[model samples]
Target: MIGAGAAGLATAIFTGRSSPHLKVLLLDGARRPGAKILISGGGRCNVTNSSVSERDFWGGRSTIVRHVLSGLPVAETVAFFGEVGVPLHEEPGGKLFPDSNRARDVLEALLREVERVHAHLLTAHRVVGISGARGGFTVDTLQGSIAARAVVLAAGGQSLPRTGSDGAGVQLAQRLGHTIVETTPALAPLRIGRADGSFHERLSGVAHDADLTVWADRQVLIRLRGSLLWTHFGVSGPLALNASRHWARAALEGRAPRMTVSFCPGLRFDDADARLVAAARERPRAAAPTVLAAWLPASVAAALASEIGLPDVALAQVPRDDRRRLSHALVEWPLAVEDTRGYNYAEATAGGVTLGEIDPSTMESRVCPGLFLVGEVLDVDGRIGGYNFQWAWASARAAARGLATTL
Candidate 1:
């Protein structure tokens, strides 16, 4: 194992336990293992999801993902973690976290399993290169070089560089004759270009449930519904993070993607228009901002009302055309996204080693025999909540099974 992250650690645990006669060595550049796990889910460590499927991921051979995941499904992951002493509890959206509500506990459980199998864990041993092929492989590290029959590359992606995934694995794979997909920051907060007078500047720190959609070249790319948070830069929160992938990819391709927030999610234009008309009729004395406040946050209502030029006017006093305009603005508030926060703040990277080079059933490299690639090191990223971690678990298990069989 060339990394000790979620995938690497799991691979070590499974490989060691399954093939006790074989020697297993897990190496990491970090001083401690599971650095990402320690900070995941705000320290709660979302280990897996209650329901996982190939559709949840982006940028990979979907067939390979499906094959690997089916081999070790989410149910099996839940049971495996439980058996390892990390009881799980499910939250909204099928997200599963440790019952203890501490990421340390989850890390400890994985470490315990690694110890149980007597796998050699060498922290601070950064792998510089790998030479040789198939049955005889030499892994070069800062400390020294070690020989191995097989090598597993789970060094992860460039999303959280501080967490020890600094694109080293991608570089290593590239050196070994693998095609790497262009990587970009995904699940990161977007940076909206400031208008002369941007409402987001004043609305910073405001959060509310909203529907977000990405549009590029006049075509809708994706739609998501979740909490949308306004920051001084642009937008953050679940909805914005989920939609960032589309926007980032489009931006990278030189196609500027426009993001529109629908404050009144699930409401048709006619329905939203009707609601405004009814509000005008029922609460004739109510101010437009006040009427909007009934459905939206006070800051959001004020911002929308100001943007629509009806900040203080009475609801009934507004003309029919202005009412229609207000309805449109309320439902489809346009935002100018300049760029993303980049990989430093991204939750996961959007691209990695292309999946075509790896065998779906075993996660072994077709280009380099005896070499396996798993986790975010491959072009497999999942949406927020616990899907990415589930990928880590499933892919690691698949690679372990393959390694055991080959041995």
Candidate 2:
């Protein structure tokens, strides 16, 4: 085993337990294991998703996720943890967390299980090279070379480098003759360097609920509605981050994507326009700030007004063009994309080992026998909310089950 992150840990755990007699050596570059798990979900460690289904995954064979997850279902995952003494609680968004409400609890549970199963976890052992063929594999590391019957790359994605997913495993896969999809940041904050630049700089602490969408060349690309936070550089939170994956990928292909956010998504455009018109009519003497205050945050509304060239215009005496601008602002506020913040800011990376290279049932590389890829290392990225963890669990299980023939 190489890279003792979530997928690596889970893979080792399952493989070790499935065959207690087999000696499994788990190698990780980090000093402590499960660093990502420790900080995931703001320390709550969203272990899995109740909404886990094939449909949640992005950019891969949808059926593959179904097949793998079917073999190691979420219920079984919950049960596995339950047996290991970690009681889980489900949040409103189908997100599962430990009853202790601490990320360390989830990490500790997995660590305890690994220990119980007698899996030898070698931490701080950075693997420099993986050699040998098929059932004979030797991993050269910082400490020393350790030979294994099989090699599983669960090194995770480049996102969260502090967690030890530093794109090293991708290089290993590439050297092993696997086709790697162009990797870029996904589930990251969308940055607007100009136009909304000042607002971006000052709106760091502001958060609002809205529907955000991204478009490329007048074509709608991604749409998500959820809580979004305005930051010093750009937008974060659910809607922005979810839409960001598509935007990041699209931008990488040389097509600059445009972000369109509906501040009032629940309201129809016509209804919103009429409401604005009515607000002006009812309060002919109403201040512009007062009229729009009800619809948006004071700073956000003021910024919108300025962006649409209506900053000085009175609400009651608002000109036709200004009203139209306000309507447009409310409907689809445009933010140009320069580039994504990259994996450092990403919750996940969108591209990896192409799904076609591996058998969905086994997660084994068709390109190389005894070589398995799991978690974000593969082209299987999911939307936010425990979907990535589900991928880790499912893909890890698939790899372990496939290795059962040898173990």
How well does each candidate superpose onto the true structure, as a TM-score? 0.97, 0.94
Model 2 regions more than 4 Å off: 266-268, 281-285, 311-314
Error of 2 at 193 (Å): 0.8
lDDT of 2 by residue, 339-367 (tens): 67777788898888888899887888898
In angstroms, the error of model 2 at 238 is 1.5
Question: What's model 1's overall lDDT?
Answer: 0.89
Q: What would the TM-score be for candidate 1 when compared with the true structure? A: 0.97
Compared with the true structure, what per-residue lDDT tens digits does model 1 show for residues 113-218?
A: 9999999999999999998888999999999999999999999999879888999999999999999989998889998886625888889999999999898888
| Segments in model 1 whose C-alpha atoms lie over 4 Å from true places | none
Every candidate's lDDT = 0.89, 0.83
Question: Which pairs of residues collide in candidate 2?
Answer: none
